[model samples]
Target: MLPRFLERLRQQADNLAGLLGNRVALFGIELQEESERLLGHLALLLGAAICTLFCLLSAVVAGLVLAARYGVLLEVCATLAVLFLLLALGLAWYLRRRLADAPEPFEATRQEFERDRLALNGARETAQ
Candidate 1:
């Protein structure tokens, strides 16, 4: 009886270890995904800022004066500057919206753990 009990205990320990390993793996995957998402967001932000700065420099008085000396060139330059700036602004707004809408970190891991907890509790209650 003692030997059988020890064998069952070892099997249960192995099962628990496997379950923990799976959860840990899920956590690692989620963390990696979140980091990738953040990196993408940062790239978008950098792109927008660079676009804004480049366009803003062209919208300066010196640029306008130089374009103005060319008559039709002034209107074209002004329009393009405005368009680029608007595009940059739109990108920034999009990034902001995406950041705000991002899901909580470790969400899947938390959910899985919650399910595990509920199952364990249910089993305990039934056993009682």
Candidate 2:
């Protein structure tokens, strides 16, 4: 009986180790995926920002030149400046909202942990 108990104990330990290893691997995979996604988003945002900067500058210059021809360059500039500022503020708020609502990282891992906890608790209740 003692020998049988020892063997069962060893099997349980091995099973626990395997479960831990799998969880670790899952976590690593999720972390890597998250990092890759972040880097890709950053790269795209940077490119978009650069393109938008040049586009806005060119457009403003063109608009200003046209307004100068009509003797309303200063007024056009002031209006555009205010419009851009308001747009920037609105976008900033939207970005903050998006970030605040972003899903938790490692969501799968967290779910897995919860499932494991529940299963372990069930097992304990049954054993009792």
Candidate 3:
């Protein structure tokens, strides 16, 4: 009877493990999806910034050439500064998005640790 009871307990634990495994798998997929989304957003934003920067730089160079010939060096310098500011802002925005979308590995580990600790405590209490 004691062996049968232990077998039943094992079966129950296996079932619980299966259920937990399914939940973890689902959550892992969700995390992967979120990570992919965050990466995609970053890639798109970076690509756009690169293209815009190249276009702006080319335009600035052309402007500088014209300005040098026309004695408008001050305006050229101001325009270049604004372009740099815009690029800096774009980079900051991308960084913010990446940070916001980052996953916390600690949460998952904490939950698993708590479950194991509880199991260990219950076993000790029952044995005592």
Q: What is the C-alpha lDDT of each candidate?
A: 0.84, 0.84, 0.79
lDDT of 1 at 12: 77
Q: On residues 1-128, what C-alpha lDDT tens digit does candidate 3 reach at each position?
A: 99999998899799778767865776687678767877887787789878887988798889999999999899888988897898789778877877787766346645775776698689779979
Model 2 Cα lDDT, one tens digit per residue, 80-106 = 899778767875776677667766789
lDDT of 1 by residue, 14-125 (tens): 9889999999999999999999998988887788688877767766655677777877676867687787777767877887788789999999999999998998899779
Q: What is the lDDT of residue 30 in candidate 1?
A: 97
Q: Give per-model TM-scores.
A: 0.73, 0.81, 0.65
Q: After superposition, how far is residue 89 of candidate 1 from its true place, in Å?
A: 7.6
- Model 2 has a clash total of 0
Please identify which of the two predictions, 2 or 3, would achieve the higher lDDT against the true structure.
Answer: 2
Count of clashes, each model:
0, 0, 0
Off by over 4 Å in 1: 62-93
Global fold similarity of model 3 (TM-score): 0.65
In candidate 2, how many Å is residue 75 off? 0.8
Deviation in angstroms for 7 in model 2?
A: 1.6
